[model samples]
Target: MPSTDDLGSVVDAAVRARLDDSGQACDAAERFIVADDLYDGFVEKFTAALLDRRSGAPLSSVAAAGTLARQVAAAVAAGATLHTEGERRGAHFPAGVLTGLTTEHATARQELSGPAAMVFRAAGEADALRIANDTPYALGWYVFTTDSARAGRVAGGIEAGMAFVNGVGAEDAELPFGGVKRSGSGREPGRPGIEEFVGKKLVRTVA
Candidate 1:
């Protein structure tokens, strides 16, 4: 059987094909960097303050997404590998075979608000957990595994407010959504969803 990441790529490809069929090539993908050898391929692009990835906009006047601006700058400073998918066209960014991420890098610690991803290398479950928790923010997390027992164990250790386990898009109206640390301060659904927005008052008088 293919690895989960491989399966994920296949799914991504399928989604891209569907998007192409719908004539939305410039719509589905946002420009971002992918580095295989952080030091060799990604640093120079940053020194000149040039865009390391490709975006759909036709003009160079286009700027990086504000949400990702800081994170991208951090990645560049940490010297992580960065590049676009092809010859750097259309706010072009690296699009395939993403690799070369380290927990020590700022990219690993920061919350990426735009179309960016970091692929860190971890030794095992414990190490992965440590890396995951090393960050200050824990809005959400994901666990993809066939073993239910392992899933439960990992889920419990993760500090995030929401977790999607085993399956993707596994959300419902009844489940409360919120986060800890800097992710969120309150819940948005379930009973707490309405409760957070409400104010209750009571009065008593002798008759």
Candidate 2:
């Protein structure tokens, strides 16, 4: 099991990396732009929830929202890519202590709740699209995507060197695995895995 400190580092690293890849600059235009204040609020809240989950520190709705916003702002300043599924018409979150924070962006027609929905709505299309294209973190260090085009892009992405799109969940003895950028370097498994346990020797015959 990973330690809390290790997990925190992982979460922070992932968050920072995503923010950097978001491609959104922290200029006055972006900072003061009130066009999507509600959506922005939602994004901040959702980000906080995820961070809290990773850190084992459950944050209150209000606290999460504030933390999320601060984190996003910091991420934007540092350049991180945000990802979402886009908005849906009929989404709702369960009522709880965080209900206020949950439905803060509820419009008269649409009552937005759930973290996923909030993220989608807040990120909008452009940032969401950027995330879909740039997010390198996948399930268990494996790249996850159903789009071939996006898969190709991720394969060549500055952050991901090897991406497996819709692959099986088994590790093969003959296969290799590795990553690029912050993910890590070098390969493992199959011959590579064995090589790590042995020394390489080249033999020649002299006549």
Candidate 3:
């Protein structure tokens, strides 16, 4: 798992990259779930970025350019507020990182499509686990801790297709990638990836 220092650095990067002009693109902004006590800097940077009017071209050109843009636009129209950074209404919708969110909020229940984040605060590890498990979607899971054993425990406990313990940036082509519950039903890459296509047949003989 990413240690407190790594977590802090990631948040610090987010804080530093608060705007398009600040040399950080939307993708660079990692959707986070840091502790409430350790969120002062994250909140500041994320909020600032969310509210600021970003000025830059599309990330790609070949396909639909404003698909994500349209999604963000529609979300804003649907009464979602940018409480932290940037303007409430604008064409350039900077990444919306919504913190202080609870189970009552709709985003907490469903998967977010755009560059948005729903940060929830848990009282303890059990609370964090409960909160994490409460969601139906489990495409990917990120765990950050200094303890290797604790990381193993958390990683094993999480219901996800891919669980990266210490680092979020690590991805092995040989490793299986898939999700459980609603977010996933099949595996990708490695042996499991190949096995996903092979149909299992069981012949029952009555004797």
Candidate 4:
């Protein structure tokens, strides 16, 4: 997936996805799996972008912010390195990035509910997919690549219900919005969502 040439746009889209709704959205991207070749550069740019662009908005409540701050602290206690702009104050949890986390870490499997990102260095495509699909929560997944075939293949391989390629904020009213696995079932705002409310009765009349 390192075939992605535009690092700037990818970083922008990634930050947008991670910070959306102050990282409270269930579908917001929580983990970033970067190919080994791009991992360092990606993390550097990503952390910078997060620090510079974060809206500094309060989460739902002060208690909610405290919970998120504790989550990040726990990750650090568990050996993950943290690169952050500022400490949590009130309901505004400043943007931070976590590195050196592995699939075995407890925080690796948990979702951060604030503007924080956990980055993993993947050896290649297979490793990337493994990290991406390892979680039980599969509401939304994102793939950034220049190759169309690779994009399709990676997107198809993702376990999430919705896969966004090369961009963020692609959700529309007409599109089905939902997740698979523990993220929840069924769709909304689309044909499938409509069917969820409909009752079907089987009637067979032989002529």
RMSD of 2: 15.5
lDDT of 1 by residue, 1-207 (tens): 001333344234322322231212221222212222332223333212222332343322225343344566567677775543444233433232223566777667765433344445555667667767787777666565556776788788888787666443445788777789876678878888888889988888889
Q: Clashes in each model (backbone N, CA, C under 3 Å)? A: 15, 11, 11, 0
Q: Judged by TM-score, which candidate is best?
A: 4
CA lDDT scores, all candidates in order:
0.49, 0.33, 0.55, 0.88
Question: Which candidate, 2 or 3, would have the higher TM-score against the true structure?
Answer: 3
TM-score for each prediction? 0.63, 0.32, 0.67, 0.95
| Candidate 3 structure quality by residue, lDDT tens digits, 64-166 | 2244445444444555544534432332334566665665555566554334555556565666676777777776766767778777877777766777765
Best by lDDT: 4
Q: Whole-model lDDT, candidate 1?
A: 0.49
Off by over 4 Å in 4: none
Model 3 accuracy (lDDT, Cα): 0.55
Ranking by TM-score: 4, 3, 1, 2
**Lowest-lDDT window of 10 residues in candidate 3?**
20-29
Q: Please say which candidate is ahead in lDDT: 2 or 3.
A: 3
Q: Model 3: runs farther than 4 Å from truth?
A: 1-3, 12-31, 45-92, 199-207
Per-residue lDDT of 39-114 in model 2, one digit per residue for the tens? 4443454356443432221223555444444443343344334343222222211211111121122221121112
TM-score of 1: 0.63
TM-score of candidate 4 relative to the true fold: 0.95
